[model samples]
Target: MALCEARLEEKARFLCRGRNPSDATDLLQDTYERAFRAFHTYDRNAPPLPWLASILTRRFLDMCRQDKRHPQQQLTESLDVPSEEAGPAEVWAGYTLEDVWRAVDLLPEEFRDVVRLKDMEGLAYAEISQRLGIPAMTVGTRLFRARKKLKELLLKKAETGGAS
Candidate 1:
């Protein structure tokens, strides 16, 4: 574990390839949690970097699969793709990461946790259910509602010019 911690930046940079730089931190976090939970299976003779890297790769793949299962279209996609002239909704064009996260932080705790686990940590609904001790159906339901709420909040933020 100490070895893994010592090489955190190295591992995170490796995880960043083919992904958003922001995802690397969350992927690294999930990998560390998984590694700690499965520490008993680690081979003491082998090096830590390769083992940790393998776990990180699996986590990224899992994240990809999860994303495929729940493909939330990017908020700006419509604005960016359509060749139409800008209108009132043109305000939706520039939602930064900070705006999304700020909106997320304002969500009620239950909704917030669901979003963070499923979206930020790249956890599957089942894993989120287990982590939060909720039924799988509830995880799905909460995630749906949370996403709806996030969209509303973000749109409001965009309309208001990035105000909280």
Candidate 2:
């Protein structure tokens, strides 16, 4: 546990993203418990944060499923919606955040970086350019392309009932 304590804040941040902030502690505890059971499987040579993060992400997804809440009512708040229009929100209501994240993970590395930085981390174009060492115009271009590709991938996933 000592080795993991310092690395948990990032997991907590990930847990709270687009999720109910109140559940962060509970989810973190649950993930820690899971990690404990699986600790023996971990190789000492590898870094722990990525393993812990993987556990936390899967734990959160499992909790969402076990609770029977995804695609029910939580969708109203989980997705990025981007606007007040119920049309887009309702279309997204059937998908869970995990489903969205899975699609994001499928993007090319550079596109994924741009999307995560801009959307998930809430970085402005200028900040993203500075961090990524790319032109601000390139940031906008990547974000636009990433979002358009994301829409296509998500639509495919939606057609397959999120199995894609």
Question: Taking the tens digit of each residue's C-alpha lDDT, what string does model 2 give over 78-104?
Answer: 344544432355457676667777888
Q: Where is model 2 more than 4 Å wrong at Cα?
A: 1-90
The 10-residue segment with the lowest total lDDT in model 1: 75-84
How well does candidate 1 score on lDDT at residue 125? 82
Backbone clash count for every predicted candidate, in the order shown? 0, 0
Best by TM-score: 1
lDDT of each: 0.71, 0.72
Listed in order, each prediction's TM-score against the native is 0.48, 0.46
Give the range where candidate 2 is weakest over 10 consecutive residues by summed lDDT: 69-78
- Pairs of colliding residues, candidate 2: none
